[model samples]
Target: MFKSKEVEIPLRRSELISPTGIGALTTNSDGINLMPGALDMWFDNADIMENEFEIYEERLSKIFNVESFRLPPDYRAPFNKYQQAEKNLNIRIPMVRFPNWYYCSSCKTMSKEVSSRKDSILTCSHCKNNYARLIQVPLIVACEKGHLDDFPWNEWVHESLGPRCKGPLKLISTGGATLSSMKVKCTSCSGERSLRGLTTKDSEHLYDHLSKEGYYKCTGRKPWFGDRIQNEECSCIPQPILKNASNAYFSEVLNAIYLPPNRDAKIQKILDLLALPNIMENIELLKKTAPIPLIGTVLKTNFTSLSDIDNALLEDGIAKIINSEDKTENNENAVLLNLKIEEYDLLASNEKIESDFLVVQPEYDKDGNTLLHQKYGISKINLIPKLRETRVLYGFSRLNPPLPLSTNRKEIIENGKSKLFIKPQKFKWLPAYKVQGEGIYIEFDDNLLSEWESSIRNSSRVSKLNERLNNARQEGIGIKADVSPRYVMLHTLAHLFIQEIVLSCGYSSSSLKERIYVGPKENENMNGFLIYTSSGDSEGTMGGLVRLGEISSIESILEKAISKANWCSSDPVCNEIGMDFGQGRDFLNGAACHNCAYVSEISCEELNKYLDRGFVNIYDATDDFKSFFNYVETR
Candidate 1:
């Protein structure tokens, strides 16, 4: 079914499974059966990460949220010069290569690793059963260093034998609750061992052994690179991990809202004209010789002469065209992080401002009557007349969450990329897409946010989030310590607002996306969130969201969202729960459940975590310091 889905998916819809959800679904116990309309596709990590530099961690990989289109049809394909041009350009989705090992469910027999796919069912060699049901093995062992492999059943069963032995093995389970009840036995040596304490809470106790060795050492198994390590030996110990474990894999995707260098329409026209490979090569010659016949044909304009165009403007446009070859040329990380600040600067400028890739207009007249600031403590509301976003997925981690790109993550990502590729050279470029759309950006009052966060109740709330972060760190997940009370508040507010705006925004709750911006300190100073819609369609989202940015409409939405968060269907129990003890092991949420604050999974960037209605609205009647919106409600 996965193979068939790969063939049936169209070019535009290839994004449905390009970067994530490749190995997520399938028919049970039938690794190679057709389920009619099922679609299974994935992109090559090496291919996705390949570019002028092998710095997959630094650039050329991320999750692109495409909302509207700015470039022409032919220019939309970012991997135009790739060797696998047909796959990247026409279909856009590539077939996922699943593991070859499969197990028979009924007979409890296993088959050797397989490569051929002509038949869906294979006869069990041990049981001599034909058409036996086989499912892909869901167990994989991995280390924090990013090495992954199959479970070492033979090693555990025949502990007496050395690692090199090829002993026959059988899996046995007594239908018990704990893993100790499940046993693995070597038919050859007649040695057997229970799987007790094998799934240890800490990585230090990877394997439980009766002998003096205490725990089993990692064999440096890397299934992704075939069954061997070619160049170097791994230093990290491998831990047995279930393939379905949440910590097994975490995709690291980077996303940036497209920012243009300038907003001159004529210059933009010149840049688009030069994007055509045919015309770009001859741009230098065209710039020198104005009034060229070829320039008029390429532009297809009524205007006669290029002599009227300013020479300085022409040079500026030429530089932009050259830089467009790879937008990640100048400090890619800065390009990624600074775009928002650039956007903020632009919004603070004159109204009706237009740039090459973006435009902004205030929702109300200059200093017009608006209650967003007076009633809701919202500082400003700016309408995004147009925006472009680009996304890509470069590398991923398993068994432990990845550290941020700012930390030691660079070394981890580089090592991971080296494991995935044979020669590890840069390819032409990575896949990318651009979209155009309009939305609203709401900035909260900094002084008010500072005042609210300084309260003792808020300090305790932040500690709860830090506890989760510490737990992840102790588990070797390497998650960043960026979650503060401000982040949680903004994240929760965005979720509740998305829920309230769905009816009026004329888009499904899933179509609307939230981007939360909060700085680490007051000097870095950012406090705001944006709710917008993106799509491959031409007109974007029918302008419903932008219309709702009107002062009156926004005030109503904020009031309703805050009021609704006061009581969920699961309240009392939800409201009374302790901040440091509840679901998700670390209590990342409070008074927030699917009944009230939660929305579609696609609508949230944090997987719907790190939210609590207690931060936004009153949880208990007499609670003084819990809710920030109580300030507005009392007024």
Candidate 2:
């Protein structure tokens, strides 16, 4: 028997695209494991869906080939009984029951039951006249192809005894430490099996043993879609995994910093309106007529209040200017790089841009010195008081980090490279959320960085790290950037800076994230990184982080960071091993470990890879010239 009740689970808006996105599981306060329902099940009313939840990002919209993005519909409660107008607007993100199998400790009976979104309680009918509470089974099965299903309990217990034999199942556990002590039995015929070897390497042995007997296989179940949807056909082998395993879901989120369209307020508004779907085409078609009055008419029809339409009409060739400015590169990587280059150009210019994307160089100290440390080549520091970052949940994977099947969006969705939506054919908008925060941007002297990189470009240590990176890429480990001495130096410095600044910035290291921008090649030469607060709270907007950009505080922090990098608790072992055999995931890190150079994975763009403290300061006499800040004496 099942009981229905409405339950509220509090979730932050940013969490919807991470840790608990679509297809990811979260346990509610009542201990009911729930998975957020598919995008198709989000909202019921069409008007509320379109007008209230749309988010606009021109670069992301063009890259993803979608009209717009949508924020997860937030639930609003009606204030009073007379507030009938607000009642219909209240919306909630739908959830579905997962791992539907439940066991009753009081009755010793195992049952499988599917419940609706509103049902939060289930009881065992065999015990105390249906008063015994049912506990959800924590075991489930998934395949690399992103299919999830309840564990095959019946087949494992019977194991060729008889599929026709219908019997009630009992899950029993003997007091022991290993999984072999837990067994499932058919109460009618006494057929039984233990749950041993189900968690071995890749669960290959268990899959082989059961699959050979024609019992355990993938059913291609997508339970996130509600109960009526049929399972798709799939032939991949399924492996038993715990419901809360870390590899259960890996979200593929894309983030972009907002770049203003124009400096003029009205011009920016007109460009934003033009970025909407089919508006540019309408303008082009209307251009054949009177051009000014006709364009003003179209703009007035599309926008709610365009009092500046006359000004837009008076401008010469506005449509042509907008079109030329709106063009983006066809290649996806090129688009992303061009977008970053634009940001780099703005941040590195040292000019104060005072719009939504606000950035200003910190004033020089009382001594009229802008340079914090000449020996370390610290060239410029800028403070961002206001910035908007948009993050979109595009797709997710089950057993691995989501990889693209092809560059083509349609092909990537169709081949199941990543599960974009329940029925991807209907996917027009992705779920996204935005954050308003502040940051500190630090840029290095290009000439100094080039000179240091050239001094050790062909050294043995540098060659070994590059070789490992190339190997990792060949094995499809997804190392996106090419490793260089300059990149490693910048990356390590960013980590040290984050670790040091958290002590005085009033924000924890977890709330501060690093965005490294290092391009050593001639065509795309850049040397800088941004440390920003991404929490979207009062702490993120406070001026504590930006105030540290002052010359006195920055110089003190840099000295401490370099001093801290000179020695690690792991010492010689951490610094020496990677040069010979390698360290960290896929041997991607050198001279770095959790105790020294690692930060929260959310803070690091490279997942804490490609780091080496030796790049920052001299740890040994033999590596003197290799250090970027070799002029600094050892402690």
Please list the Cα RMSD from the true structure of every candidate, rounded to 1 decimal place.
11.1, 8.4
Model 2: weakest 10-residue lDDT segment is 312-321
lDDT, candidate 1, at 160: 34
Q: Report lDDT per candidate.
A: 0.55, 0.74
Encode model 1's per-residue lDDT on 191-306: one tens digit a residue.
77777666677422445453344565565654444333342466666776555567665555445665455444567766665566665656655545654344444434423344
The number of the candidate with the highest TM-score is: 2
Best candidate (score: lDDT): 2
Candidate 2, residues 1-635, lDDT tens digits: the string is 44657745677778898768988888888898888878887765654646567899987887677888988887777787776565335777877788888888677788888747455667686678555677787778899888899887877776652365566887777888556678888889898888876766754344566534564568889888778888889888787888998888877677777876554444556666665667667666666664555576666677665545555322323543433555554444445555565567566655577677888877786553534545467777888887778888877778766653224444443444235466766767888988878898888877777777777777777787788888887887766645678889899999999999999999988888888877632123778999888775643388889899887888889889998888889888888886767787678888888989999877886667888888887477364356888732221
